[model samples]
Target: MLQKIIFIFLLVILVSCGQETQPKPYGELRLEYPKPHYKLFNSNSPFTFEYSDYAEITPAKKKDWYNLSYKKMKANVFITYFPIHNDFNLHLKEAEKMVYEHTIKASAIDTQSFSYPNHNVFGNFYQLQGQTASNIQFFVTDSTKHFVTANLYFNSRPKPDSLAPAIAYIKKDLEHMISTFKWK
Candidate 1:
């Protein structure tokens, strides 16, 4: 009886030891976001644009600065308005400097120039890739009087892969806002 028990225990151990231990494959996380519905943002400020109804717009402490907060995505778009006041170049430099500041962490920065001659709106939209603090930055100005800059920041860690879905969603809203932006 003891010999039979010992033999069975040894057989079980041998079979278990022969089995290969494999690591589970990694899977991507799926995040679903609500379809955005936009509405014209009517503000008493110098300019107006369409914003996603999904986001909550809050007036920043500074004048002409607004925070478009997307709570679900843990992101915020900070929009700042600056009157050119014969300092168009100065404001342009400032905007460029802000975008460049993220270069340390950004893998690449692609800029797209936008022109709306009829509305006198023209500027560069910057898409920053990689683990950067700000994923997107843009500036629109009449090249004379009004200068506006907007930057998108996520409250969480900058993981481009994980944040791709949220980033893409917010990007569409930003593009829409830029397209419909008008000087008030």
Candidate 2:
């Protein structure tokens, strides 16, 4: 009787082991952003520009400093203003140094110069590609009296692949702000 029971159990196990297997499919996450609406940002500071309504603007510790915080994206654009007391070269050097400091982690750095003669708004925009802490940096000046620098930072680990969409969206807003910038 014991030998017969063991044979029956072995047969049941062999019958259950012959099923087919299926492979799991791969997938990617999709992110969508709202159409941007901008409003003119004017303050007691010496400059004015258009900023995205999606972001909240708050005063920084410094007198003329401000932060454009994007809560949904977990990022901020920090902007600082200074009076160029015949130290334009020094300011430019400092801005350039700040941007290049990320070279250790940045795969590539591309720069584009913007000139708005009518508004006296001229600047250099730096875009850093790769897993860098700050992907964007810029400085806009009238070359004699006013100097302004801005940098973009995300509040998370640097992962270029995952952050591409948010970076591109914010970059568009930054470009628009630069184009519409004016010195007051």
Candidate 3:
């Protein structure tokens, strides 16, 4: 009986050893994003634009400022509106300054100019490539009165690789917003 038991135990051990111990085969995480659905943000405010239906807009402390929050994605778009009031140049400078402020941590900054001449909406969109607090910032203006600036920030740490999907997702919304932007 003892011989039989030992033989069985040794057989189990030998069989187990035949299987090579190996680390898991590396695989990239698959992150999926929902297809975008937009809603018109036509409010009593100074401007109107199209925004993602996923986001909920809440008024910031400032009268014309809003924090558009994406609860599931843990991100927010901080939007501030200033009526140019003959200070368009000042607002333009400040918008450029905000983008440059991220230069310390950005690997590269790409600026793309877009205009919807039919809507009278002209804008600059900046994509900050790196682990920065805000990955995207933009401002659209009629170049006469309405000046609106927005920043997109994730609630979590700025891990560019991990956040790339979300960034790309929100960018579509940004594009839609800019194209549909209109000053009231």
Query: What do the candidate models score in CA lDDT, each in turn?
Result: 0.92, 0.96, 0.91
Per-model TM-score on C-alpha atoms: 0.87, 0.88, 0.94
Superposition TM-score, candidate 3 onto the true structure: 0.94
For residues 13-39, could you state the per-residue lDDT of candidate 2 as single tens digits?
999888687787888889898999999
Q: By TM-score, is 1 or 3 better?
A: 3
lDDT of 1 by residue, 99-142 (tens): 99999999999999998888888999999999999999999998
Show how many residue pairs clash in every candidate, following the order shown: 0, 0, 0
Q: In model 3, what is the error at residue 102, expressed in angstroms?
A: 0.6
lDDT of 3 by residue, 104-171 (tens): 99999999999889888898999999989999999999899789999999999999999998899899
Model 3, residue 178: distance off in Å is 0.9
Residue pairs with backbone atoms closer than 3 Å in model 3 (clashes) = none
Better of 2 and 3 by lDDT: 2
Among all windows of ten consecutive residues in candidate 3, which has the lowest summed lDDT? 13-22
Model 2, runs deviating above 4 Å: 1-22
Candidate 2 vs candidate 3: the TM-score winner is 3
